[model samples]
Target: MIPSSRNWQIKVAIAVLTLPVVFSPVSEAQVSQTLKAKESEAKQFMGLMNKAQQVYYAEKAGFTSSVSNLLVNVGFQNKPDTANYSYSIGMVNKAAVFNYGVSKQANLKSFVGGVFLVGNDTQTILCLNAAPGKIKPPNPTNTKGVLKCAAGTEKIAQYNYF
Candidate 1:
């Protein structure tokens, strides 16, 4: 009876140790599938942007205005002080550019900024916004600059390619 009990304990330990190795492949496959789904979702948004003129315009304006404000707040103070600064915001070729002319000239850390989404639903208007052109936000995976969004939110779609 004592010998049988010892043998049972040993068998249980071996099974526990082997279980992870046996199931690891299955988990890996699931992860791959999840990633593919996310990629497909992103592609769908990109396609929408490419075809829908109004949405593209809105996204471009939103990105431009957001970036302009960020630049001004981050020590780029040379503007109208009281009056609002206006810039011609538009998408040039494939990239969104906010042409401010020479109204407020300060040495910017970088001229170009990257746009990214910041919401659970990629289809949501609240999703697309640019990160600050100067400061890289902590935990960029979850937030863009000072903005925070839900986890599993998609980053910027591939509209930049167009």
Candidate 2:
């Protein structure tokens, strides 16, 4: 026996409603993976900057604020902007720092100063971006882990990004 037309319509409606439920988790996972990739890229950039600063310091006894100097002179010529991130290795108050700007403007609210790492003579300091447009606990604080930030900044402890 065949089902009535009314019954078939009810089944179709149920299937349509359930489609989103099945796909929602997949969408969320995709986004999470993408963010993870972006974070990895950011950390890689930080490392490259560290090497470049070392070279510059070895030659000049201090750091340069120009990203161009890091890329052209030291030969770390990777793309400055990734698919989901843009960044600059520069000076804040004559101190060397690495700043990251995300493609998602909404995320900017959570990533104030777009800076994740700062550096000095012996160690690296992870700047805490707790507030919008400002990094809290000040520089040289031992909150986040250590990252080898470029020269011209403050540092004291070792921390890991992953």
Candidate 3:
């Protein structure tokens, strides 16, 4: 009832071919690429929240600290948090600061989005942390009307979305 030598050889070859797929760990490059994708997603999420805040402010005449308010008032669809990041918003010295911090992955970068007034026009800014850790957006300066990120972060984009 035993299989022939040729059949056994073919089965062994097939098993060997599938072994790497089954037991191989993800490579460093692959991990890096995945972390990069998550980082991009975090950034995009911040952008979307910034836009939503713009719309909400236009209708409400003020900014909201709650993402639920953005969803209900502005009709923007998003989860407050994701598997890789957690989102938050609050009034930081008269500015609406949106923050996204790493939730599960250490390699993913954190982000902050700020909505504030600049010379009678509303401005939005997106900033990225220098490295992955718990970072918060700094309060905007009253005299300069600028939203500066904390020392370890850098501003990546700014917009005036009306």
List per-prediction Cα lDDT, in the order shown: 0.34, 0.48, 0.72
lDDT order, best first, reads: 3, 2, 1
TM-score of the candidate numbered 1?
0.35
Instruction: List runs of model 1 lying over 4 Å from the truth.
Output: 1-3, 54-162
Residue range with the least summed lDDT across 10 consecutive positions in model 1: 103-112
lDDT of 3: 0.72
lDDT of 3 by residue, 84-145 (tens): 78887777655455544443566666787778866656788787878876455453333476
Off by over 4 Å in 2: 1-4, 92-104, 108-120, 127-162
Every model's TM-score: 0.35, 0.61, 0.73
Ranking by TM-score: 3, 2, 1
lDDT of 2 by residue, 1-162 (tens): 999999999999999999989999999898778755665555556556555655666567666667777677776665676554555554554334443333443332112122233343423343323333322223332234344323333332243331
Candidate 3's C-alpha runs over 4 A off are 1-26, 134-143
Q: Name the candidate, 1 or 3, with the larger lDDT value.
A: 3
Best by TM-score: 3
lDDT of 2: 0.48
Q: Tell how far residue 109 is off in model 3, in angstroms.
A: 1.5
- Pairs of colliding residues, candidate 3: none
